[model samples]
Target: KIQRQMGSSYHPEVTMKIQVPFEEFTLQIEGRADGVMETDEGTVIDEIKGVFKNLDAMKEPVQVHLAQAKCYAFIYGE
Candidate 1:
């Protein structure tokens, strides 16, 4: 995937089927990031999205994308 290819520069790896336990139950979260990029600055979580329309049409979807990215960031501790 795009992330994997980009992460090759930083020797990135993928984490699959990550479980987050809560008080009531556990949430099963799955992700296949483009790749994890490590640099002198810090670790970067890459999320790739393909949209075939104007930004207006994609606003709602973009919000979802950002939410997913935020989750990924939280999971990765970035």
Candidate 2:
């Protein structure tokens, strides 16, 4: 619903894969971002996570989930 309002700037279910250089090898990271948006400011990566508990009880995003979002952003930037 909200995606439709954003028009062409919003891309839903975007899959991204990227490789990063490590100490002596390369690391590959791949995942799907719920939505990616392009705006005057910059690119936005949206990651959706299902909650089984009260949302209010969560003070911060899960570390793994946050890492995935960061990976998506890095892939897009690359």
Candidate 3:
């Protein structure tokens, strides 16, 4: 709904497979991002998270969320 106001464009439920070398084994990191947007600011990743509790109970997003967002950013080569 909110996306209509934003000039950004996105690909929803997008996934990418990347290989990382861990010692002698190749590690694969694969998952889907909520959405990836192309905006004037730059390529942005939209990671939608919902909290069940009251807004006050929520703190900042956890490290994992930030990391995941960045991983998606890397996948897009932005």
lDDT tens string, model 2, 1-78?
777887789999898998889999999878788899999999988898898989999999899998888888878888
Per-residue lDDT over 16-42 for candidate 3, one digit per residue giving the tens place of the 0 to 100 score: 668888999998888788877787788
Better of 1 and 2 by lDDT: 2
Q: What's the ranking of the predictions by TM-score, best on top?
A: 2, 3, 1
How much is 27 displaced in model 3, in angstroms? Answer: 0.5
lDDT agreement with native, every candidate? 0.71, 0.87, 0.76
Best by TM-score: 2
Which residue pairs collide in model 1, if any?
Answer: 3-34, 4-34
Q: Candidate 2, after superposition: displacement of residue 2 in Å?
A: 6.7
lDDT of 1 by residue, 1-78 (tens): 654656555444466356878999998997766667777798887777887788776536668889888887777773
Model 1: weakest 10-residue lDDT segment is 7-16
C-alpha TM-score for every candidate: 0.64, 0.81, 0.73
lDDT for model 3: 0.76
